[model samples]
Target chain A: MSVSTVRPDVYAQVQHFYARQMQALDAGRFADYANTFTEDGTFQHSPGAQPAVGRAGIVAELERFHERFADDPVQRRHWFNHVALEPLPDGSLSSTVYALIVTVRPGGTPKIGPSCVVHDVLEITEEGVLTRSRLVTHDQEAA
Target chain B: MSVSTVRPDVYAQVQHFYARQMQALDAGRFADYANTFTEDGTFQHSPGAQPAVGRAGIVAELERFHERFADDPVQRRHWFNHVALEPLPDGSLSSTVYALIVTVRPGGTPKIGPSCVVHDVLEITEEGVLTRSRLVTHDQEAA
Candidate 1:
């Protein structure tokens, strides 16, 4: 049973945060995307994989991931759904976000690429919301 | 630009409703799953595909889908994440739910199956919450 204690605005903010993060990644603004996390943020791309810790490390890892589309003018968009947020005992919040990545090849229709999900541990403070740790899991058959 | 006017309780209810629907399907309780929709509920398995209209039709379609594993006792579970809800202009709420289906072959570890997303138009009336229409889309390469 889930309680309705979380404010509606918080949900909206989280959604917006994800949207902006996706936009930044799509636009090749890795720095902007990395800035959404805390100074010591952690990003794990898959199970049993090492996480990219700290903003600099996250940016580096993301850049490496983007290398595939570097030469080509590929279009990328992330669609997130089934987002669930829960309060944590550490005065923070956790969110489970399911995502679908769509890629458009040159002069081709958009095709679904990967089905990914992120478990985000977020800290909300007066300074603003920050993602402390995010563990991402995706179908191994992602194209 | 989204506004946070929707009640938090609505989000909780939508999440719970989806959970129950998935549970019923996994348990092979087709009737219970069908009951989650309205009298004239519609379910679209893929974009531009013919939908199963009405509760009876939904039940029939779902039963047909389950026929593949009818001979064997297959384990099924659905994981839904990143659920986004927005208030629509027609007084119905819209939800974008990302779902991953996991299938466990007899005596094997669970493997991911189709990764799909459903955009559901929900009606919350005094009678109860109902799924008016659901549009599902998925990766063409999904197995």
Candidate 2:
């Protein structure tokens, strides 16, 4: 078995970046979330439909998502789990994050759901931020 | 912004581990998948029901999942995105991976689905294998 080359401090960075992502998402900070991606980033869903590519595209898509959710009076607590991050060569990182979402309606039962797999290839920005080259596979079964 | 402790070589190790994990999964080697977690590891879904803790429990849960699929006589290929491995102080790692699951029906069209998010905390075993401390989360919505 080969010795691990990964240093200990990367976890702190990733944890920090992810926490910000969650905070932005929960606070409906679409613009901020969009900025987490690289300049030429891409977000692809299913095989069909056009993918949201580049920083501008990500911003637009997040904005659209925020707008659509604006009408939903229910509050959702987005919980994530089963996450695995592997480092790639050339300064990029590929990671997988699984989510178990629970949507709560006021004075009603909360709806729980199965795994939503989010696979991404990320690059650490010069400013020490995590940006996406590609964010693939956002399970939308809950929607 | 703080400087990064995650160097390129470290990323390579993280990348290889995940590639091996997926390879084992696709080959129907469930035990290898289970072995990817630590002894006191926990796999949580929805924070309800008992977390699949320890190797035995994790194996049992995965067996159930594989059994259900095997009974259905389906052929599926769940593609995974790159792995992001964030190093922890103890030389362990926290990671996130994104996946796209496309299930092709028996002699039917392949149905594409949304991405799921998987969040995990893992530690490297004495043998150098990456093992999970916790595996949790789910899909956002319908595939």
Candidate 3:
């Protein structure tokens, strides 16, 4: 058997941090998920040209999600992929992950929504929080 | 207790495949890593204007990685960020994945090398292979 020795201990923790973000969002716990980042961290949909900067921007942008789905279903699932991990010189682990996040519209078929492929640079902070610089590439434009 | 509930399965699978490719390269398995894509996959590095087309083109470029590295100690990690996964009506996943790739040279320093952030699109085949389109994106040239 080709055992997948993905070093779950060190890298697994990194993935778990990411998993939390997805879980919170799926559970309609956006506030909890948004707080996962550091105060000075960034979340940019597009990297170089233009990006929504900082925590406030991130939080505000995330708000649109809930607002858009204010009357939508509370249950959903977010799947991520292309997760890559690397150990930094500071003895911390960083990773990049992508996932297909599906929000099941209540009382309707589970329609495939917007897909995102992200570039994330994160380190496990002293307090164990993940501090990251994120750049999101949008494959599907807003409908 | 929060979990990520992203949309689309192919997006995650594509990301998984990309991550696996990097891992294989770190293990000194370049050929194996390169073979993960279709025979006509295109690879665009730089700021994008032009892409290296065809599997042969992509392979020729990536082979340089093998020639440059002596062993597995050389680690190059590609971190991805804000991913947008789009589910096509045809059932395939159309994705825009933004990546921040940090490369580590094998020398004792082992600190960090320069990084490149790229936006790429992938077409996942019915047979489970991931392929890049020969066409380039309009914004790929900007940054």
The residue-level lDDT of candidate 1 at A30 comes to 84
**Which window of 10 residues has the lowest lDDT sum in candidate 2 chain B?**
B104-113
Name the top lDDT candidate: 1
Each prediction's Cα lDDT score?
Answer: 0.77, 0.61, 0.56
Of models 2 and 3, which has the larger lDDT?
Answer: 2
lDDT measured at residue B129 in model 1 versus the true structure, 0 to 100? 78
Candidate 3 per-residue C-alpha lDDT over A1-143 given as tens digits, one digit per residue, 9 for 90 to 100: 02223344545456667788878766766557657766667777564444545667667777865687777555568666557665567654456555444656557766433445567777665666565677765433321
Which candidate number maximizes TM-score?
1
State the displacement of the C-alpha of residue B78, model 3, in Å, after optimal TM-score superposition: 17
Score every model by TM-score: 0.61, 0.55, 0.47
* Candidate 3 lDDT by residue in tens digits, B113-142: 233344444555544536555232333334
* Tens digits of lDDT, candidate 1, A1-143: 86856577677567656655665666588888788888999989887789999999999998888888677766666768867999888878889988787665554555666888889998876545678999988876454
Residue pairs in candidate 1 whose N, alpha carbon or C atoms collide under 3 angstroms: A81-B81, A81-B82, A81-B83, A82-B81, A82-B82, A82-B83, A83-B82, A83-B83, A98-B82
> Candidate 2 residues A73-129, lDDT tens each?
776666554345667888777766655456787788976543355677767666875
Model 1: TM-score for chain B: 0.91
Per-residue error for B46 in candidate 1, Å, reads 1.6
Q: Model 3's CAPRI class?
A: incorrect
